[model samples]
Target: MTIELLAPAAAEAPTRFVERHGRRIAYRETGSGTPLILCLRFRGVLDSWDPAFLDALAAEFRVITFDYSGLGQSGGAASYRAEVMARDAIDLADALGIESFAVGGWSLGGMAAQVVTAMVPERVTHLVLIGTTPPGRVEHPSEAAFLEHALKPVNDLADEEILFFEPASASSRAAAAASNARIAARSADRSPPIAPETYLALLQDRHAEDLFPDAGGYRDFLANCGIPILVIAGDHEIVFPTPNWFALNRVWKSLHLMVLPQMGHGPQHQAPEFVADLIKSFVRTRQRADVAA
Candidate 1:
């Protein structure tokens, strides 16, 4: 059976703002309830969202998403530090009049989410991290493995199966490809093209030595956080091993982990129902906590 992926669906007008650093950050939102910002993965934009995923969450909470500095429609040097990226997220929240809210992110965006939550612990009501890890991994993927399968240039990835969303069946694969192709087609120009210079600059400019907060700090922050957390990752996730998240949960007072099968780098895409359900469950837990408090 062919799964028909609906369009982007009706959404509120997207807003653009220049972060304090003068980098323009573009964001958009939908629905109306608790503020919920959906931070995206590396090399992604607002248009890359999975419509079905958006539809489910947008119905329950005020959904937020943005293009980060140096990517998508946000114009800046391709070299913004994670601190700057985290600040952009906080600034974006301020722009949207969101004082406190739940935060969720994937991959690089997931790392940024940690920074955002730590930077403004008071403003973040709950936290969700997916397919990410703290900086300078103690168990980083092998260089040989990266060379053999992961680090190829973007243009060279056409035939490689998307590690993020592994299509379990031919039908599912077709559906997933169609969805990505549609988004790719629509944002052909808007999606940030890989800039060798920009990518290199970000790689070279590492002055923000503390840009990615260390795992020790991540543990402390989550342990002391007054909110609940839902840490979701793919069972087959190769980006950051499950043990990393296990280490994080060990530090948290109230954090749970969900490892989904038939998934990888992007749970929001490959397991949208699971992701959406997790959000709903977390929101309910937060509400209960508030009532108890």
Candidate 2:
């Protein structure tokens, strides 16, 4: 069966739903290649993804972006726990008949992607984490201001700039505006925003132990997991500082890290095409190395 691939643009891709585990998962896909399932960040719905970033990724990958179960257009009980969210991602893949694929996530979504990789290492071909912290202890924690803006029901351009980009850098601020405009292009069929109360509940539930009960186990898995892992961050990231990943530099043999200068949490948004090219190169190079082995 030949499936038509949608154009690699946020405004062009149509929102679709699939039933899995008695719940409907909302998703959109573009391009055609190895399936890349992307999880959403904290307080982010399907519409929250930057259009430029998604379009750039779709150029090389069959990028699949989706709202978590119970969030946005999905139908289910809402829960932001990483482990539960990991199950949601796996279920989506199963429903789509995708046996193996690359998994990518940003911020909170990155946490879920890690859990997914750990849960089914054999099925995950690659792991891409953006602006997220690794499991266990964080060397440099997020700034308190992040919660102030992130928990808000509606984030204006200023809030977005503070949350994702480095307001201190004029170029970063300009990039944020451009990214916002691209995201706003998708005016129709957009998923609803997450409520403030729901996001608050997420923060409350994120106890230290609950977030990472067995940091040692997860670190060990990441160290030994043969799957190629890519970590992208901004040098000025306030939310999940880049130093946290640097702290684990020698721990993982297959781990690759890229830090964008003068940017913040959302490096992909600041330099969508460049980030996409890096990902394509990373995946291609690693896959070729594996085949050679």
Candidate 3:
């Protein structure tokens, strides 16, 4: 499916950068209001962001989107820890002189958001945790089919694309497959091949391992990491899936759950309006909270 490049918005295109840690980060600015930072899933680039979804979001935010280190036009670093990626978010925010921003990401990006909130609770005012799992407290283990992609090397992502979006119509499958192909071609020219080890590192960072060493460090994060957490999950997500999100909602009661009936892992992609509206609403609520407090 050929994605229509929606009408171009008069927004600034991001500049490319190699940070102090040797990780490449690309960022662009749009709109003007409370800052809304966009973080991508693991191994995704800034361009992979759907333009239509972004255009809708720019309607209300000074949206900032970035390519995570080691992916896309960005170069990979010697490190791939979640904390390090979290630092990248903070560093990007600091570099841009954004003292406070409403932040969120899709899938792995959402997990990275957790790291940022935990790192500096005061800096991130409104948190959006979509298609993610908080570390330690509880998590439904992903099925073998989902885990298979990480364990084995599959350069052709045709099979994986189907698992990403739901209502798996032929058009959706074809469009996703085409999208992956485009990304693969772009990465071939700009970045290194994603080694299995790197993929494993990300999975480990997200799961049972205690990055902070303390038994309840991460749990404490969910317990008191005060922020308006938006937990959006695709009813059809085979990767993180809905169960993982439900478990998250139970633990973090402040979180607002948005379950898209026919959607899968990428809510922003499958149901952009549902997501864009939620972000706008959350920001509004936060603004009210600030005025009230």
TM-score per prediction, in order, is 0.80, 0.94, 0.76
In the range 167-218, model 2's lDDT, one tens digit per residue, is 9999999999999998888868999988888877776776664335555377
1 versus 3: better TM-score goes to = 1
- How high is the CA lDDT of each candidate model? 0.65, 0.86, 0.64
Tens-digit lDDT track for model 3 on 1-293?
88954323423344446464555566766667788887776556565565556767888887787766665555566244557677778888987788998888776677677778778878888888666666653455555565555356553555555446653566556556554554344332243445677777866655544322324365566554557777787777766656755655556645678787766666676556568897888778853122111
Extract clashing residue pairs from model 1. none
What is the C-alpha lDDT profile of model 1 across 1-293, one tens digit per residue?
Answer: 99954324423234545554576777766667788887776556777677667767876777888887767778775544556667768888887678988888777677778778878887888878887765544444522332344434463323223556553545446546655654554433344554555554664575443435474366466565656777788776666666666665555656778887766666776556668888887877763133221
lDDT value, residue 130 of candidate 3: 67
Best lDDT goes to which candidate?
Answer: 2
- Candidate 2's C-alpha runs over 4 A off are 1-8, 209-216, 288-293
lDDT of 1: 0.65
lDDT of 1 at 134: 56
**Whose TM-score is greatest here?**
2
Ordering by TM-score: 2, 1, 3
RMSD of each: 5.9, 2.8, 6.0
Q: Backbone clashes in each candidate structure, one number apiece?
A: 0, 0, 1
